[model samples]
Target: MFDIIIRSATQRKVRSGLTVSGIALGIFALVVMGAMSENFNQTFENSMSLTSDKIRVFAESGMFGGGLTDDKVPDVKRVPGVKDAYGILLTTFDEDQMGMSGKQIFALPPEKSRIALDPVKLKAGRFLEPGDTYQILVGTSIAGEYDLQIGSKLEIHDKNFTVIGILEYTGSFFDSTAAIPLETAQDIYNLEHSLSTIFAVPEEGIDSDILAKRIELNVKGTSTLSPRELQEQASQSLLIFSVITISSALLAAIIGGLSVMNTMLMSVTERTREFGILRAMGAETKDILLITLGEAALLGIIGGLLGIGIGSAAVYLINLWLAGKGIILFAITQRLLVVALLFATVIGTISGLYPAYRATKMSPMEALRYG
Candidate 1:
C-alpha cells in the first residue's frame, strides 16, 4: 500500500516537485536564520563566560574614579567570602594624532588577573610582554581595513608604534579592537596611575553578588557586579541580532509549514475518489489517515534534507566573503545540521495532519458521486 502511495505521488510529478521545492526554499531560509542567530548567541556566551566568572568593580566618579580601581583592589580581595582580585587599566589612544586615521583604540594591561581576557587567535606577531615598549595587538578586522601586518607602524597620539600581533576572529565586539599594555596606554593617553576597574573571583560556593555588595560597602565610590550581570550587559549589545535572526527564521518556518498544508489539501481533493475506493475495500478511517499522513511526512523529510544541504552551502559562501575581511567565525557543527533537519521534518509532519484527517473522513458513496 505504501509503495502504491509512492507510485501515485510520482504520477503527479509536476505538482509533487513544485510542492517539494516550495517547502525546501522555506526550510532553507528558516534553517539559515536559526543557525545564524544561535551562533551569535553562542559567541556572546563564550565571550562573556570568562569575563563574568569574575566579579568586576569599577570607579563611578573621577575619570577612572567612577569605575574600578587599584585603591579598592586589595580591600575587595580581603573582603569576606572573596577569593581573588586584580586591577586593570583601560584607556584609548587616537591614531589620527600620529598621522594615522583618528580612531580611538582601547588598551589593556597584560598582567595575570581574576578576570583575564585571552586573545582568541593570533594571525601575526605576538601578545604584550612586560617592558615591551611601543608594541600593539590588533584584531584581524582592523588589520585588513587598515592594511596592516607584522612590523607595520601605527601612529598613536604623535608616537609611532609597531604592530606586534593580529588577533584571530572571535565573533564578539572584541574582534575589532586593539590592545596594549596598561602603562603604555596610560602614558599615551596622559592618564597617570589611574585604572579603569578591578575584578574578583569568589571562593567555591560563595554567593558572588553578596560578596560584591560586601566589598562595595567596604570600598567607597565603587560598584561591583557578578559574572551573570556582566554577561547580560554584553549580550544586550547583540540583542538586536538575536531578535532579527529568530523572528526571520520563525516567519520562514511558518510560511513553509503553511505551504505544506496547502499542498496536502490539494492532494486530498484530487484523491477523493481514490479514498472512496479504499473505503469500499474496507479500509478503516485510521488507515486512510495514516496513509495520507505518511505520504506527507515523506515529502517533508525529502524537502527538509534538501533544504539543509542548500542552507549549509549558503552559510559556507557567506563565510568565504567574510574571511576576506579578516573574520572567519561562521562554523557549522554537526549538531546544528541534525537540528535543522529534524526541525524541517517536524514542521512538515505537523502541517499535513489536518489535511490527512479531512481525507480520512471522506465518505465512499458521497466522494464517488461528487466531482
Candidate 2:
C-alpha cells in the first residue's frame, strides 16, 4: 500500500510540489515573524532594565500629567509601606541634534543615585556615582556619535560633564541615551521640583501591587506605573511588527494552497479514465480515495520541507544585513526553527485536503466516459 502511494504521489509530482510549497511558505512566514518578535521583546526588556527594579510614579495634575512637583517626592515617601522614593525627570536633552530627546529616560537620584544600566556590559569607565556633578554614563552608540571617551568633556545645560563611561551594546531604546544626575537634569530642563517621575521599592515582604495602589491613592501629584505597565506600552509598538509578519505568512499560504489545488484538480480530470479502469478492475472505493489523499499529503509534506529551508535562509540573510548596520543584539534560537518546520508540514497537509476529497467523490465510470 505504501509503495503504491509513493508511486502514485511521484506520478503527480507537479501537483504535490505545489501543495508542499504552500505549506512551506506558511511555516516560513511564522518562523520569521516569531523570531523577530522574540528579538524585539528581548531588546525592549533590556532597555527597561536601565530604569532599575523599581516602580515609577508620575504627576497626574500638570504638564503631561505625569510630572511630579519636587515637594511631592517627600510626601509620596511618607506613604505607609514606602521604603524610599527619589525624584526623576524623564526627558530629551535640549542640545541633542539626532532627535534623541523623547527617546531617552533621564533618571535622577538626588542622594546616592542607584540607577545603573546593564552594569555587566559597562564598556568604559564606571556607572554614575553620587555627588558626581558633571559625570554621565553614555551608551556605546551615543558615545560614538559624539566621539566621546573617558575624560572627554561634554556640556549639558551649560554645565560640562566629563564622560565617565560608555555602556556596551545592548539592543534597547536606551542604546542612544546618556544618564545624568537628577540635579543636573532638573537644572537643564529648567523646572523646579517639577519631576516627571519617581521610583519606589516596597518594604520587606509587602505586596508590590498593594503598595503601588496605596501610592496611587495617597500620592496626589503622581500615578504609579509598574513594570508590567511599562511592558504593555512597549509591546503595543511590537504588536504592529508581529501583525505584519503574520499577515505576510497567511497570504503566502493562501496563494500556495490555490496553486496546489489548481494543479491537483487538473491532474484528477486528466486521470479520469485511469481511475475508471481501476474501479472496474476491483479496486475498492476506499483505495481510490486513499490514493488521491496520499498524493495531496505527499505534495504538502515536500513543499513544507522546502519552505522551511528557504525561510531559514531568508532569516539568516536578514540577520547579516542587520549586523552590517551594527545591530547584533538578538539571535534566533534552535527551538524556533523546530516549531517553524512542524507548522509548515501541518499547513501542507491541510491545504491538500479539499483537492483530495473532490477527486475521491468523482464517479469513476462517469469520469471515464466524459474524458
Candidate 3:
C-alpha cells in the first residue's frame, strides 16, 4: 500500500510538488509569525523584570502635561513601605541637537538612579558619574541609528556634551533614550526643579500595589502604578499588532488547506481506473481510502519539515540584520516547530477526507467503463 501511494505521487511530480509547496508556505507563515509574537512577549516580560518590585510615579495628567516637581520625591520617599525614591527628568531635543527627530533625553541623578544600583553593562566607555556634568550615555539603539561612538561630541540645546558610554540593549524604552546627569538635564532644559517621573522601590516583603497606592495618596497630583500594571498597559497597546499577525497566519493556512483539497480531489479523479483495477483484484474500499490518506500525510510531513528549516533560516537572517540596528524581533523555539508540524499534518489529513471518501464510493464497474 505504501509503495503504491509513493508510486502514484511520483507519477505526477508537478501537481504533488505544487501541493507540497503550498502547504510548506503556509506552515512557514505560521512559524515565522508565531515566533515574532513570542519574541515580543518574552522581551516585554524581561523589561518588566526590572520594575517588578518598583512603582512608577508620574503626573496624573500625563508625562508631558506639566509633569511633577522635585519636591514630590521626598514626599514619595516618606510613604510607608517605600525603600528608595528617585526622580527622572525627560526632555526632547530639536532635530539639529539630536541629529534626528523623535529621540528622547533623560536626566537621571547619577547616584540615585536605578541604573546605578545594578548598572547595565556598557558596550564602551563608562556609566555616568556624580561629577560628570556634560557627559552622556547613549542607548544602543540611539548609538547604532546615529552612528555615534564613545568620545563622540553632540550639541544639545546649544551646549556641547561628549558621549562617554553606550548602554547594552534592555529590550525597553531605555534602549532608545540618551541619559545624562540630572543636574545637566535640568540646566539644558531650563527645568529648574521639575521632574517627568519618579521611581520608587518597595521595602523587602512589602506589596508593590500597596506601596504604589501609598505613594499616590501621600504625593498629590501624581499617579502611581506597579510593574504589572505597566506591563498590562504595554500589552494593550500591542493588541492590534498581535491581531494582525495572527490573522495573516490563519489566512495562509486556510489557503493552503484549500490547495491540498483541490490537489487530492484531482488525484482521485485521475486514479479512478487504477482504483477500479485494484478493487477487481480484491482490494477493499478501506484499503483505497487508507492509501489516499497516506499519500496526503506524506505530503504534509515532508512539506512541514521543509517549512520549519526554511522558516528558521529566515528568522536567523532577519535577526542578524536587526542586531546591527540594536533590535530583536523574532525568537524561534523548539516548541514552535513541533506545533507547526502537527498543525500542518492535521490540516492535510482533514483536507484529504472528502477525496478519499469519493474514491471509495465509486462503483468499480462504472469506473472501469468510464476509463
Q: Highest TM-score among the candidates is held by which one?
A: 3
* Residues 107-142 of candidate 2: C-alpha lDDT, one tens digit per residue: 576253433343436787877777776788776656
Estimate candidate 1's RMSD in Å: 4.9
Roughly what TM-score does model 2 have, to 2 decimal places? 0.75
Q: Candidate 3 residues 50-145, lDDT tens each?
A: 556678999898777876888888899899898888898877745555534445787889776435324456788888887899998888777887
Q: In order, what lDDT does every prediction score?
A: 0.72, 0.68, 0.81
Instruction: Give me the runs in candidate 3 sitting further than 4 Å from their true place.
Output: 90-106, 114-119, 122-124, 139-150, 154-160, 168-177, 189-194, 236-240, 281-286
Off-target runs (Cα >4 Å) in candidate 1 are: 60-106, 112-115, 118-126, 138-160, 165-177, 187-196, 201-207, 231-244
Instruction: Give the C-alpha lDDT of model 3.
Output: 0.81
> Would you estimate the TM-scores of all the predictions?
0.77, 0.75, 0.84
lDDT winner among the candidates? 3
* TM match of model 3 to true structure: 0.84
Question: What is residue 125's positional error in candidate 3, in angstroms?
Answer: 4.0
**Candidate 1 lDDT, tens digit per residue, 70-159?**
567787788888787766665444433451322236555555411355536677677777677688778766677668899999776677
| Model 1 poorest ten-residue lDDT run | 95-104
